[model samples]
Target chain A: MKPSQRLLVLLFSGTAALRGGGFFDTLDDKTRFDSDALGLHADLSFMTDATLYVPELPAQGLLTSDDHVFFVPRLMTFFDAQMGDRLTLHTQMRADRGFDPGAVPDGDVRLDEYYLQGRILRDDDLNVRVGKFGTAFGSWAKRSLSWNNPFVTAPMAYEDVLTVSDRKLAPSGVKFAQRRDLPDNKTNWLPILWGPAYTTGLSVSDRIDWVEYAFEVKNASISSSPEVWDAAQVGFPTNPTFTGRVGLRPAPEWSLGTSVSHGTYLQDSTASLLPVGSSVNDFTQTTWGIDAGYEHGRWQIWSELIGTRFEVPWVGALEAVSGFVEAKYKITADLWTAFRWNQAAFGDVPGLDISWDRNGWRSDIAFGWRVSENIQTKLQYSLGDKSGREPEGNHLGALQLIMKF
Target chain B: MKPLPTLLLVFAGVHALIADGTIEGKLSVESMKPSPSRPGYLPSPTKQPVLKPESAPAIVYLERDDGVYPRTKTNETVRIRQSGYQFRPSMVAIQTGTKVDFPNLDEEFHNVFSCSKAKHFDLGRFRKEEASPEVLFNKPGVVKIYCEIHQHMRCFVVVLDTPWFVKTDAEGKFSLNNIPPGDYSLKIFQPSERLIQQRVTVTDGQTNTVNLTR
Candidate 1:
């Protein structure tokens, strides 16, 4: 009477005989096991969004404001388990409110990802994983999940909105702000890679035969730092960061990829913007990308291009470049329609007398509506532009609603 | 005593008309190409051409150590349906105690299941204004069918405890009427070929062909 209580009494009498069809009439053909040997899947969702900002603007400081906003940003929850046919264990968790960047609406609960995979050799085609994951890079940060995003924001090379620092007042008054020099700076809507883009240690991945690869080392660098989500109060690093990716798949509905990453994304508490004796490997941060996709039967398409640099030992090499090209179409079987366009560019940063808006672009157009296999709903509209910004051009409108269980 | 039961029913009606007999076949498929269309926004090629299993129809049967073969009492009911998301007669063969009927002419909600070691039911999700869920297969072999929330919705059913099955046309031709005078053992079942078996001999009113190339 105790093999895990006889497997919870044979899983509640086989879910009461799968509700009278007699245990799926002698079950065992698979796909309804949420737990056959210690399983427990879950992926709960609940989102709500709304944004509007057309012909309005005025707030300028802690990173621009003034337009319209609506809440319930997300309420995610994952959980996954399956500790058997080669071990596993995952976890996500979220909760939000409104404006997010380095996230601080302070309602708590964030924990993003937690890994622990394993499934090494013997034709399982390798796999290794070890703790805080996500960042196998490219193909949109592990499919920016909101039910595998077809779009609801994400992809300006995985999210953008920059600026990073600005503040002034010194001459005996003191207020300091040189974290890589900024002057009138403002525009930190943030997310050029952050949000379940988690990081923090060993990964390994495999899938030979049409190629697929991954390699990680982690513990910081995909920017938006706070140790990329509290790496135990900023500690471990004598050198870590090193991401990777390699995909291929030519046909079975095409795919193609390439990604890379490097190290030291600054932070010994910014060491006063380095060079008083320089160190953290003299400040580095590289990146690289290229992606592609194509589905079929109801269309789908994707594309990417990315690039990033940074160097900086006293402010020198700064670069950026992003790309995008989405698509989707399904128009019934529960509708869908999408389109994207993204763009970005940036470079020039010699002594930084600063006047840098350095290009930006966007263009969306969505419309989803599944309303059933666990509800969905979307509506988007965008058009942006920023080249030495001052409201150079903008108009957005979003609306989302997702529900799953 | 009533003329000895009318001479044993006129010698069982002349042994059922000299055991009928008529097998005929065709089923080729060697280099069988055709598979290149699939790039998205569909719907508009409908001059009929979407009965899957690589172009539908193919199931021939007949195997005999001679014993259990008497269940032919039809009111005919095979149906299948579920339109648009397909499954309409993706292939069927029946006769072991047939009575299929699925129906759910699509306004969504389908469920149909089948685990197929010969049989394993499941019809759950139903709806489409209800009423139409029959089953009665009585085992014999190939079941397949699916649609548990449309994972591509396929179909296959093939049953057969010998009423001498047949089902081919789409140019693969077949015909198997009243075959009961023979050495039998023919099988065929094509879905990407291979599984053919032979050995035939049905004489009495004659008509036995059986080609089946590659």
Candidate 2:
């Protein structure tokens, strides 16, 4: 056997002697890895979802012309190496497929998170994390895993589409025109905020008594499209984006917090969209939100309100406000029922006539069953309504199965 | 001759006072501030209720001096029930060589384990209808127990070589009956409180009352 394998076997033997049996005999439920061992540990989990969408009216823009059904699958793998008790390395990779409504099915694999975390002063009082990781802005980002989240989809604030394309088109193919007859002006394609939900950054966090706080600096702005950093583009912004959050525990069953992010949103290639010789900082995006959660007995509830403002040069100013409240009740030890209301309001751009920019809201209801410790199934139905769209309302049904190991 | 006989009888009676005594005490705390609660995020069920710190009981015992007391045998099985995601009798006092049976009374699965100095054992996950395995604790010290799946579930077991120990009631009252008359060190243990020790003396066939406050 290899040296590492022999070493692992010896370590397990010693642990068994100390613990009186195999490592799995005790089952360290908090972490997936064998924390007793100091070397590498691995974990894997996956989710498969089948969704059907039906439109109340003739579908337009990104939506297909008729009813559509597709399957979405995602796989996540994590590797953790503990150098010692004070320092550790963590890396997570994800493979996802079937998210784009207008494109053909394709699988995309990427490194979702990679970080090296260590203690600075004390284990609980102070710590520093460097590298790419999920944003520590709100409660949802930290608990968005398939097994952790009650619903299949993310919150509207994190997935709302911003702009479909860069240019507006008319019969003459004139770009950037705000005419109502322009085909591009009516296009519904838009970039979602999923990119900003994860970023490369350095964060300092601490927990003191009932309060916890974190402050981070990342390479790009909140909701910036094409999240991957390209150092070749205008020599990476000197002043990076800043995000922070503070949470408080007032009662054993309640938690309240607030988060904020501010930074330049325009890239070097998109800098000309603002004005001639305008610096990237001229178009800045700022977002702030308040979130609260409560769990007691057989009921759990979570709510958040987020507002984002974009400072543009010619298009006046634009603002988007979104909020959601979700609640779940356990019908039994293995069954749960949940409901959520999500809504968003966008300020009209002076010269733009995109229908997707209108106000929208959606309601979702779901029932979930835990078939076993490693398997869970959920059935959810959602209704959506938007003003100034061909399909003023839509219906969606989804069934998801999750497996963990 | 009758007076001499009576004197001999009194002398024998004075030396025959070997019966056990009773130690009664009330354990009170200065304040019972509730701990701040947080919503369950991962690995824990959202339906579980928070356990009030004041409702949990404390453990009280008389420390045994080596070679002064006989090693007691505990044949009766002490059961710690798990229901509503909380350990019933969150605090318990047990004699050395005692057998503890952990039964899952709730509908969900529960895995009970302790990493404390007194004993280290993990009763793997068991369902409500499954038979609970028993553990034998032979050492004497504090054993901190926790549910591997539920972070909020916690319990403490105080094991001692001597059989003279009792757990405080909800009203903070405890009675240790049939304790042999002697002078020994008394100890009180409560979660999140400082360990308390005092010298106590018991008289034969009398109930010694002690009020422990901190």
Candidate 3:
């Protein structure tokens, strides 16, 4: 038999043991291969969500609805191949094509991430990874997975859109501020920090004593689309973005962390619109964030504060602050409830006296039940509106069924 | 030609033997086949992969009808160590009010936590040391243990009110001794919390061979 077949055979030999529950019971098995020299493992999670919106939802382009209720199904899978104790190959794939912004390719299948990593220290996690990976920016990226995140949608700082554009430069602050009236025009709007910056990059991290630190250099800015994640992409710039995070765990139940990132936010399409003495590289996005978390008993709480400034083509430094606090309580072994409050505020334009973008706050509450070790279902409700906008289609109810293999 | 004291001793020994009862059996997995709850077909574009069973060892025990099993409050502690990103002896059954030690034997840190209804706890992250963290199981139910840092690491603590519980060995064989001569609810709990029960009756001086089939 081939090596792969032998590995599978070795992995399945122990499958006959009696099945047991995980923390919630019914947890998907993390199949192990006894052979220490080489092993391959995989996990697949499927989510099908149905939503009912009263007026509308921002990022209106995200999901489609015929009447008032909409439904979407997505499948996410990840594979990890361990060549040995020191080397590993990781790949993540999903079926939702347009789930990520700047996913230029039009298809049902998208490669979200693929990286090869090597361990430097035998006893420590000092390692290096090459290829596309999640940005080492904030605490959110690490918990973006469906199983890890409490809500179906990400925080507003990572999901909500602003009037500013990376593809087209606003002629004036007047026009940029007016665009907020048309929230459906998401094609030109951008989120302060894009979701889970899956850009091509190299990163290294280490944990020593009570401190943990990681740093990475990526091909594009955190706000860039997944399509341009690769250096070979048409609009990928020569200069790389830098992102880093420092975490401190002084106590077992409490943790504190801070992160920063800097990169050019505009695309090549804005090159021709540049001012007389500047290039597209002149515009950049700089951001800083602080995060804290507490885990004890049946309660877990996490909070983050993010501040960002963007160098608009003509407007120069447009500023924004965004963040959220989330708490989850395990009601029982099989049930849990979570709540998150999100708010984003934009600063006045330089000399324009007008705000750069709309200010909005949203709150989401969810209840989840683990049907079995490998299956879960969640129901969530959200309510929010933009500045002076009543019922801006932000009120929603969603139900999701999740299964793992 | 035995002395009067020897005759009395033999009669007492035979009486004691007639009073105690034993139950012995072999427990094993039904099938390694993938459960039926999974999606029948792959809606995904990736290649179809073979499905494997999720499994744990069986813990066989006897339950009295009165919901009470006469057990002494023993100070003996059962230990489950965190080592090599796994919980050693991943499955165990212990009497209620027993202490279970969660010692970190790994080179790195481990945050052992569980949300089971029987006992909820989060033993903050700790590295290997001489001191070990422990928990007392005062309630009778399944306690699922997991390492917050390592998602794959897991262990199950089957806290039982009965003292007549025995986990099957590698050969799927187990023997429970000194049971009172009475009827009981012979139950088996799988690691997944799947339960199977049967009625059993014991006679004086009898060894009951109750081999349960998958």
Candidate 4:
């Protein structure tokens, strides 16, 4: 087997024992693996039938052409060496292997995430990274890219929009964070503390500058694509983007957060006289959203409201509003069931017609059976309806088993 | 100063009670592992059970001196209420020979019983406002109480012979008040967290505090 292939097997075997609650951390006091200091993790997942629908197409554009089960196994590892009591160097490598053509070329090892993060000030809660790191955006997004969420597949809205396939995993920058204790308790005006425990400042591709805080307001500015740096001679001045976010946990059981991002996909400035080369100048897009969730006892409930406005330079703009409310209840310690209702509407724009115009609604129900701490199986069914365009939407059901370490 | 004789008489009477003393201390529950220098991985089965590491709040009473000496009275009224098909207080500890009263507060009836090594008794289904069932704890051990109808319904009955003990508060802090001044053995129990023991000496007018971590 290739080096990557051997690594994948090792990661899978290591995950088998990592299952169950973490209280097991108390079992052994001594270090188990000293020579390797090795860390391996793998997630083997399979979906019965996968489908992607595009409302714009005349026949409800469907992308599911294969019926056989598809598996996308992931392997992630890191190398660490302490460079004294205060400084340490670390490197992470992630690979995704599968038969899907959408995967990397040659059906070989693909680098999903690779980064190096070093401590700048050991006791100051400051860190610097030069390679890639996952974006610390929403709660679900940062939970864990591979095996964090409760479900096999992420929410439809989060998956379709926030997930920019090619660049989703390529978060290369540095961030600083520190956690602090607050005085507020349940009796206070705000049940939980409201303040930034720590903050981070970084510079990524395209000369973008991003600042993030634990609980305070954060802001970021970036151009459309990181590959583009100079725009003066390239016809279009770099179309700058800005984003701001505020999050709070007013109560121990409640969390409320909101974020807004506005950016323009700067079109190629230099263009030929023919309209074919330069039909539109720039496509401006702005998205603002709010999310709230509560977890009490065996029941967990959450909801989110998002609105996106797209303004075509020459063509009119289109507005889309989407929201979803979901709740999960644990019938038993190992068995759970959940239901979600989702709705979205797209405002009409002149000259440009879209199928998902007016309004759309979808519903999903899922049941999860936990085989053990590290493995679980789920079955979900979803159906949706489009108001103006198609009287009936698409219905899909999937069964997936996930093993994580 | 002339009335000093009267004040002395009152003080003597108060001191006549065996070992006049007060115990005031906080029980700080902490999580302990092999090493804090290295980060340990907590898997699913091993993951902390409760979303929050909440130590079970316990109220303990020890009877001695030919009577229910501490806590003013020995005849205790222990009511395990049934709310929303679950036990309100998951655990309860009382002195030996104490009568535990199980009152079905819910509209429906409930059957409470325990079959553990410590104690065992069956209280048939009782409706709202019905007469409560009483169980005399004969031994010092744990009594696992459960409802026949609800699988998740659970509570504990801990009987002890000692006359000195404290019940932890929501903050995981406990105090054994009015404890006799002397050398005493202390033991702390919080389900699944850790069991701790310590020896303490209480002076005539001083308090000895003990802090432990799991």
Best of the two (2, 3) by TM-score: 3
Model 1 CA deviation exceeding 4 Å by range: A1-140, A144-148, A152-157, A165-201, A204-216, A224-237, A241-264, A267-331, A337-380, A383-392, A395-405, B1-58, B61-189, B193-204
Per-model DockQ against the true two-chain complex:
0.02, 0.03, 0.07, 0.02
Q: What DockQ does model 2 achieve?
A: 0.03
Q: How does residue A397 of candidate 4 score in lDDT?
A: 58
- List the candidate 2 regions with Cα displacement exceeding 4 Å: A1-67, A98-104, A164-192, A226-236, A350-356, A391-393, B1-214
Candidate 4: list runs displaced more than 4 Å: A1-65, A76-94, A97-108, A114-131, A144-146, A160-241, A266-281, A351-358, A388-393, B1-214
What is the model-wide C-alpha lDDT for candidate 3?
0.67
Q: Tell how far residue A197 is off in model 4, in angstroms.
A: 25
Q: Candidate 3 at A177: error in angstroms?
A: 3.4
lDDT of 4 at A360: 59
Model 3 agreement with the true structure over A232-280: per-residue lDDT tens digits: 4553467778999999988666779999999887887788998888887
Alpha-carbon deviation at A255 in model 3, angstroms: 2.0
- Residues A1-405 of candidate 4: C-alpha lDDT, one tens digit per residue: 545345444644543454432322223212222221333221122211121212212111121123233333444444444443333433434454322212232245433233434445433333454333333334444433333445444454443221111111111111000000111111111100011101122212111012223221112112122122222223333444444455665533566778665655434432332135443234555667787877654566778787776544333455667777888776664577889887776554444343224355777788876544335566767766555334223565555555433
Top lDDT hit: 3
Q: Please state the CAPRI-style docking class of candidate 3.
A: incorrect
Q: Ten-residue segment with the worst summed lDDT in candidate 1 chain A?
A: A166-175
Docking class of 4: incorrect
First chain TM-score for all predictions: 0.32, 0.78, 0.86, 0.59
Cα TM-score per model: 0.32, 0.58, 0.74, 0.46
